[model samples]
Target: MSHPQAKVHRMFEFVEAIGTLAFSEMPNEEFLALGMRNYWDGYFAGRAAPLGLAPAEVVHAVFYNFADGEVARHIPWVWGKTTPAEAIAVRERGSAAALRQLIGDLADSPGLVRVADLATRAAVSAPIEGRVLYAGLRALDVPEEPVARIWHAATLLREHRGDGHNAALVAHGIGGTEAHVLFALALGMRAEEFGRVQHLPKAQLAAVVDGLRGRGLVDAAGGFTAAGRETRERIEALTDELAAPAYDVLSADELDELITGLEPIAAAASTVDD
Candidate 1:
């Protein structure tokens, strides 16, 4: 579970992807380019520093995400007035080798990892969004081995609204895949629409559904069979091991500002803007 550098773990990628997806509100393409993976790399490494994480461990933790396209390209760009080039020689090549050398050097740098980790933790944890997500993950026990395997897989699909992929949690699970296909089917889409949303080949999609049917997960009507319903129930149980947050705390004034723009689309509101 300690895959500071885990894209290679396959299972890690699935779970990590899920954790990432459940947290994002942006579209897939935008999230993909957000440098989130690198941000995490910097984050975990910093923890391993003065907080008790060694610089070497930080490097490894981050390295794993880099392979998942989470880190994507290891390059530098402008950050307001600060460029990575100003302090880190690793930016010179923008390659994994470059990243390694730089991180390797920082392994011995005084107070650097501490600073990075603190900054990252501050930025990530301060958000309302971050609070909700951590609350959820901090509550999980992975249910069963099949779920643990595909949790990340579910994340992969969840993160992107359009980009082609499935959640990481199910990447290696036959039963997981079976559940996934039925879940999608139940959501209601024609073959063409389903084709557009599916991350796998059409045949693969059919096969997953077929496998579920073969195992009696679906009935003759193509809905969940008793066995399939049990699977669905299990997945749902895992999802709610903790209470989901309620978003009803908005004040009349605050809610007014939030929904004011959509008043035209909705009904007229008595709460007017200042």
Candidate 2:
């Protein structure tokens, strides 16, 4: 049988999709109307809003994936364009609108209302120690609207999981670039693609890959060796284990209901155009 935590990790993706769609699909005009220069400006500002104008270094440390310079380029400067409150409003509004567009009447159905309630309980009950981003999000007031409430709760859970994942990576001594390379190899994606998407310099990417190879985590052909795969698996398992605490507040039946209720909504959200 799969680890119980694995189920929570896997099933949470459907709710994650809703938040991802909201962030990526929010219209350009909406951002522009807020005096934000571009998508990145809005994205950085909106995501970091909960921290109340945090420094670029803080965002880089918490986000734990993007290159430091990439984060420095947007934050603080993005705050100059709009206040944290305004950015949060845009994010929540966009999330609600995206859910409505994707799931239609299902956005307000009894099933979703239950999900909002259950997810909120899990989110709020999550322990705050060492979960900086999740704690920041927890400080925000829950949205009154059903769709927004669900989105907000999902986002909280996502960040809670993300913080745990970062801790797992750190414990394994994997740096940010190395983490990307390992994940790409795990997904069978080309290393170059991750480099391009993350804007990592070619030399830096090659060096990280070389380091992985030296450690026997990667083969000469740029794929995970047996040990490498095992390492990645361990990291993921630990991440699930860390993320499990949030859902501990729910009963078995409530957890099942949360997962089942999200199934159709996640399926519908998946149909969105790429």
Candidate 3:
């Protein structure tokens, strides 16, 4: 029998591999030099429009997963400087240029193209996971080479799951700073640790902790209350449910095959480190 989490595993590892295209050990100096204010601006600007969100909205929605100061420092700089469409266009152009520059002849390497083709084929079959990602892909005006398609397909699947997870968080009354705190608590992280990764100021995070405590989702010591643990599980369960539609298009056998094909690429990508 195929593994039950095969599709989930495939989605995550493929996403990881594609992520390395932009964030691997390669120098981003060339990409950063593409006339953007900074790396954050270029990176965030490119995705802003496809997310259908303003810069501040993007910060609020997704910044917790990144560095603590990104929201505070970068949003103000990128917003209103360029229109959303323009910014996304700039981001795409810059990212593609950077990838091309970095990958060099590797862009057309037979092994790379072969893997990309396999990934894209699986992505095409993913209705649920591919929905948001496919929309973003459709909005792009850039030409796709083998490497570009690989990255874009993987990114779409990842973001589709991410967008659903965010929605699940909000639907469960766990938005904003509070969501970050609760998530960390559920994972057994300490307050100080979560604080370092959270975008909220200490004062704000403290307040959020206080607020969650009142709701019995967190203890005074920033640990999860029973209710908190249950809620966190529910959020994850719902997020998986929301993401399942995409994977549903594939049979268990197909999922097994996809995961088998993608794991090596993910391992190779991970080796690049930070």
Candidate 4:
């Protein structure tokens, strides 16, 4: 089978390569100028841990990806292969602009929130999901790219919720449809109630309900099942991960302030998935 984790491998590889720059035998001034210092030190070395590479490898990954243009460049090896001195060379102030663009380009960026509404619930509830997700990323020992897909999937679910409360539901077979229909058939509306609230035609609704029942995420009565429970756990975990760094850096009140910023994101993350 194709590797499901290819994106993770690539992302980690990015970190691994960029982290190496710190040890480049270049001038200390040149190294510092690149903005390659404490970033990796704090992330990979901190709670993220040695994920099959040493501290330096992670930094090298970012530098190489930027030089090669695997990500944002939408091009191939933009910088080509250059000696460490050539790569880090700086002759004029223009170098500053170049460095800034380079940093912005290479950043994992457009964080999930940027691409879509992150959390829909109270920003605090959503952060719980972000914090868990980051933890999952750490546990996976992969880069954030693959894990991002999961978050993107969650964002889709939130959008699905209010409109049919499933604007983004990918037919996950749970009550969420968007949120993986987290609660079971029992928790979901009853058959007659569905008749009243459902946006789908009667025939289509029956089919959809049948599909959910077959999947074991729901029952005839629309109660939750073990599989459905797992889906919620996964979403909850991801949200927690996204919010953890803020939680760590900010005081409780400060964290609340940050959550306020994340509200839009939480809404976006709950999308309907396929």
Question: Which candidate leads in TM-score?
Answer: 2
Q: Write the candidate numbers in order of decreasing lDDT.
A: 2, 3, 4, 1
Candidate 2 segments exceeding 4 Å error: 1-3, 27-29, 195-198
On lDDT, the candidate that comes out on top is: 2
Backbone collisions counted per model: 27, 0, 2, 82
- Model 2, 56-140: lDDT tens digits are 9999999888865888888899877789888888888876787778888897676777888887898888899999999999999
lDDT of 4 by residue, 27-63 (tens): 2344345443522222222211212232333333322
List candidate 4 segments past 4 Å from native: 1-188, 191-197, 243-249, 256-274
- Give the per-residue lDDT digits (tens) of candidate 1, residues 1-274: 1111111122222223333322222222222343434443333222112212223433333222122222222222212222322212211112222222323443344443333232222222211332322323223332222222122223222222111121222332334345445555567532224533255567765665666677787665567767766666554433322111111233334323423322221121111111
Model 3 TM-score, 2 decimals: 0.73
Model 3 agreement with the true structure over 224-260: per-residue lDDT tens digits: 8899989988887776676655566566766666566
User: How displaced is residue 226 in candidate 4, in Å?
Assistant: 2.8
lDDT of each: 0.31, 0.81, 0.61, 0.32
- Judge candidate 4 at residue 4 and give its lDDT: 21
TM-score of every candidate relative to the true structure: 0.31, 0.94, 0.73, 0.27
